[model samples]
Target chain A: MVKKLRNYIGGSWVDSTATNFTPVVNPATCELLAECPDSPRADVDKAVKAAQEAYEEWRRTPVLSRAQYMYRFKNLLEERFEDLVEVVVKENGKTRDEARGEVRRGIESVDYAVSVPTVMRGYKVEDISSGIDETAERQPMGVFAAITPFNFPMMVPLWFLPTAITCGNTYIVKPSPQTPLSMELVYELLDELDLPEGVVNLVLGGKEASLAVMEHPGIVGVSFVGSTPVAKIVYETCAKHGKRVQAQGGAKNYIAVMPDANMEASVANIMGSAYGCAGQRCLAGSVVVAVGDAYEPLKNELVKRASGLRVGYGLSETTQMGTVISASAKERIESMIQMGVEEGAQPLLDGRGVKVEGFENGTFVGPTILDGVTPEMKVAREEIFGPVLSIMHVPDFDTAVEVINKSRYGNAASLFTSTGKYAREFKYRVNAGNIGINVGVAAATASFPFGGQKESFFGDLHGQGPDAIEFFTDRKILIERWL
Target chain B: MPSLNTFGAILTYAIEMESRLRDYYQAAGSEERARETDKRRSNLERVRRENVTEIKLEPIEGLDEADYALNLDDASAAGQQAAESTAARFYTDTAPKINVREVQRALERCAKQHAENASK
Candidate 1:
């Protein structure tokens, strides 16, 4: 009951010419939802060329006119918000609540784009030195493409697309082959806006399609969100081709808790940070560092609450946790959990053998917590990206921050503490891009830049806010001294 | 009690409550129920869209979905009274417990409506 998904290029849904296609299976029921066409390099070329053709006219269009499209798109999204959220739930395996949250974030980005005319304003000075004037205007770069990850099919691409297009750059989006339908649905909405034919194009595929976007000379910039390893390759490839690139990679975020933290609130937030979205997000708190006097109580409460979470299909009303993205993802996550156990970390709750009655074949992994984890273990340092939390006990906050800072990834870290001194110190000392004080996930909203440091991010600017405006446009300065 | 350990979980329960009420009203088939069905349906969409931000991840304590369960199976006038009373009690009991100001206010308004219905 599944048909081959098509690529939306040149304002219409066109079938990919590739001979091969990738299977997209629902993680909850193991049903084939659709077959994603493994679009070849040629599709990417066509998309970029189309975008290039559109950019010439789109760039000349007034910024206010661009903002109008975003406003209408925002209204359209709100009108059909539930339908989009349902698509996210079915395709991405996020619970309805989580999918709603994702759409909220995505729409918030579109909402932000509506204010682009104000945010993208340039600077002008009447006189710099002796009757000289200076003005700097933000001009849209040509064609840009975003290669988004599967975990957030709607939100992640929306993070870049609205701003990129509103800033006057024609765009091509290559969604993860695993979950391209949500973006395809979004593209339908974009097509309804009826801008120029190629203003925003969607190309679906795997690595070859991505490589084409990177290697294509017409594409001025590239935006990527995925694994750190692949992000590095994208960065290097874009560099060799002299294109601006922003590549957000994997994370192993930590949430350090102090003894004085409100235990009830701390435990609840920790459950969300570690287990929400089944721990697939880049900002997900994968490690909990318990400081002196907080170890026993925090560990006990986290395990108790996590074990109580109801795991089922995303569509289930009361389901608190859902399956990982795919069977292979489930396998990888379980193997990582096993690896942690082999490395001498204690598994307090093993989710491996859990099964739902109707969805016996569902790739479900119940919430799992591993204790006695040290800083040296691979599970402690690596990105597990599953509903797995590793606990490490430290004597004090300094040691906790030390353990967190030693990691190669610096995406996010949070401190749950009642002490103002500890909170301030943690904020000052932590190397992560996002820091949380008495909070769980340090994720940034659309109004602010979603940041990453060290190996976690590879770019001059970030995904949202003013960083996105800068990323999509170049500043052109004019100095005049008219006699 | 069914645990609702975060604002997200609480909001999810709220959405289920409204959607169920809408369905129940549609099944009742009275003119009032039919009118109430649209109100409940609008409330469901409002709660779903207006809320559900990433900020809802903050912890919620001491709320349970079981406390708000509607006894819609009972079809008599007495059962209707009981359902209204239960809905009133849920909104009254949990309104202040919600820390988000807008959601708390919404629950209070819902409580007032249910309480008025229960009295009638």
Candidate 2:
């Protein structure tokens, strides 16, 4: 039986006004796991109204009380933690360990939000003038909304929700219609807390629901994570609506392998980063700029490891790489591979038309490695968002940096080397927001903001850490003179 | 609950156990189980308050603050179950050796409650 999911609004499960429902499929087996409401603008308006009504008291609620809710919610999350991992695998098509890792990343955000009192503490100054005092308070913005992507249904929503709610702001989350079922389960966990009605809400739909969130007068801020095209629209719409906005877009992360680096470890890290989550994440390594003499050896080793990766269903404990999100996603990735081949990029390992033994209906895509890729190749420029790694060889470090800086994206970049001076230079000179010396993913922990630069990010303040508190609130200064 | 030789030590450990159980129940899903757990938590709170009052009224001899030190481990389900089981065993082993009649009765009842809750 395909389960039917409802939107959570005003502390209740609400059916959508739209008669049509969208089927949510498990990517691993292409099975319809549930049917999420193709919620219309009316549903969005109702949810926004509920959030607006709840905002008055929620914003006035003591910060400590809000923090207490996060604490309790965190406890509840940890108690049923395995269930979340299961959901991620069942719907998001990530391997078991990868799903667990995503859950841990989400928990880190909650853990950071638990320090709300300390993280959100405002500044105070005395004696600006004789017998004068000034204070600044970090106050909540009325209501906030988040539009997340399909790749990380569990972790990405948390990047916005806990911090926004902990800052005393009511919130509405519109998860990707592709992976809407997990957020429904998450709402059940939040409902267990002692929060007021409509403090947190979920609306499930596609573009119309997103348009509703962006245009809703009650929503004062917007946070989005998705493709660059959609993120640009979200940012522009939020700006037009006169709301605070943070729209983190897609990425084409690159890894530079130096000659002095550890080849074995670098190859292993490249394979994992390129194929992990089936390259669905924004931080997945899509390009590798092997410097000088390292190109031949690195390319050979990478192809060997990429070809050996086990591709099957995410639920299998032995499966190293899972399926792409959907059949369309698989088709898009294969077409991109064909584009690269036609564009003169050497296909060292072609994964086209690959099929698992029994799961023929699955949206599976094996890892593909392309060599002799150039900076001008379409495959190197655009984000394929699949298990395809393009290798572009450079003469030296300077040439590598030059080639990497040519791309329009500046999301994340990494270097594999043993030299301190070179690593320091790369760190200082890289144009990306997140950097790694010997790390593969370069994913920020909860203590720091996870964001990008240039076209990769659309706003000033990012999602996690202290930046989240700033993004969700405004500071008000108070000046007093005693008579 | 080891041979602490003081009513204050017993009360301190018992109070910690009750607090953990309360948190566990607050996160519980079933309405019936939640209500039952809430009642048990209230009973333990009342026992804690009575013991605290007694401690203030008549100071226990040979009592040290160090005896009540706590070691909070991981709060996962298995960890919490182990904690409850350990507390039940502590009360069961220490109740018979207590010289005070009221403290002995409280310890025995607390043991029975923890064991029952843990069995669920």
Candidate 3:
């Protein structure tokens, strides 16, 4: 018998009112894992109410005090980083190393959030107006909600919630149903910090629970990371309800390889960005637009490197790629490969029939590559969200720019080139939110704002960096007049 | 109150629509030997269409499918076929033998759905 999962609400674990329960399956062996509470409207209401109630005191907590709590949370995360990584690997089907990377990234977010006292500092101007003193600062948005996707359960939530909480606002999180256990553990750690009751809450469900939170009047703002369509719904619905929203959506991230670029370095970067976590990351580079004659050499190198990647359970140290989130994900990746083939793209390395001998039931798709892919092919246009790479050959830099520009998702784009001119032009020409010259993964650090343009993101900005502190807290301008 | 009621109704309808579509796909996939599965799938699709239309009628517009599709016909066809086959395998056999084409089509459908939904 599997242990039943419970929701963390108002500072304690509680049984869900919903009768329907979803079994958390291990993507490794298709084993019956733990069961998570299927949250309903009633549960959402309870969590929201708790968060609302806690916000009053939480927002009033001094900045230094809030910073203290964040430091404690960061310490807790670091101390138990290995444990969290294990849970992520087991529940989310990412490699142990990749899970560790997520843990590190999540901790980094927390660390950044801990610096809220400085990041949230106000700017002051003296005598801007005659005999008037002016100042501007950020304040908490009361009770907020974060709806994070399964790809990076731990890291993505920390991207928003830590800053939200550190800025003295209560939060309710709706983690992905597919990978709820790791988040539940994080919630438990939060509870250990002895924060105010209802300061942080967790509601686990598919769509209904998310809808309830988004529709709730108590939630003043919502920060979401998921597919574009769902992000739009969250953004529009929350906006309609008069809530501030920062919803980051899907990406068809491009990595343009210049003819003069180093093939080995480009291939290495592409390997990590495209195949890491089985290419489930929102920032994962799905499309590689090769310039001029770089296509053949880059394609051969990518295929060779991708083929050598080991696919298995995340716990295995030797495993380079792990099982996908579910069997459905494996099927989806395979279909995209088929589409690539049907669309007349050449398959250099096919991962469709890959089966790990010992773990036959695991949702594992080996690394795959398609050559001579065009912008029209499904593999090139769509976000496969798996360990599959689509290579599009462009005759020149202009064609590469056109191809990257034509993509609907403008989340992140990278250019691997030795020439400064090509890098500068690509940087200026590409329509993505995050850009990289030689770097494959252009994810912004804590200092820079992270978000995309076009259909890749909804709402105004992204979570983390400067934008996160801004998102968690509202800006207020104070003016004084003397007659 | 009207807005709240409309929102509630839309939520219920969306959930119901998702469930029905899932069930229909599952049934169609499972009843591989039976010819009625196709009709069942079609009925479920009709319900999905109606539900989408009804939900969109609310003052607050829900997500549009146009925002999510790369190539609607190809993605949907591939997804539907994959769902049908997976359902068939799940119901009829204990073995986990899956057709590569069916799995691939299903994968494309899923990714397209993600892409479409994310775009919205």
The parts of candidate 3 lying over 4 Å away from their true place are A128-130, A481-483, B1-120
Against the native complex, each candidate's DockQ, computed on alpha carbons, is 0.43, 0.02, 0.01
Error of 3 at B108 (Å): 47
Q: Look at candidate 2 and tell me the lDDT of residue A372.
A: 86
What is the per-residue lDDT of model 2 for residues B1-120, given as tens digits with 9 covering 90 to 100? 122323333454455555655565556533554465456556644453333211011112233324433334455666556656766776786666444466578778878876775676
RMSD (Å) per prediction: 2.4, 14.5, 21.0
* Most lDDT-accurate candidate: 1
Top candidate, metric TM-score: 1
Candidate 2 per-residue lDDT, tens place, A1-483, comes to 777888999999888887778889998777899998878999998988999899989888888988998888888877776588789999989876577667767877898998988889888899899989999999898889999999999989999899999898899999999999779888999998958999999999998899999998889999999999999999999999999999999888889999999997777667667888898888888999999999888988888778777777777645668889999999999999999999999999988888987889889888999888999999999999999999999999998888878878889998999889889989888889888787778888887998699889999899898799899889999999989
Q: Could you tell me the TM-score of chain B in model 3?
A: 0.26
How well does model 2 score by local distance difference test?
Answer: 0.81
| Residue A464 accuracy (lDDT) in model 1 | 93
Q: Chain A alone, TM-score for each of the models?
A: 0.99, 0.99, 0.97
Q: Which ten residues in a row have the lowest lDDT in candidate 2 chain A?
A: A311-320
What value of lDDT does candidate 3 attain over all alpha carbons? 0.76
Q: Fnat per model, in the order given?
A: 0.36, 0.00, 0.00
Which ranking of candidates, highest DockQ first?
Answer: 1, 2, 3
- Of the candidates numbered 1 and 2, which has the greater DockQ value? 1
Error of 3 at A251 (Å): 1.1
Q: Evaluate candidate 2 and give its CAPRI docking class based on DockQ.
A: incorrect
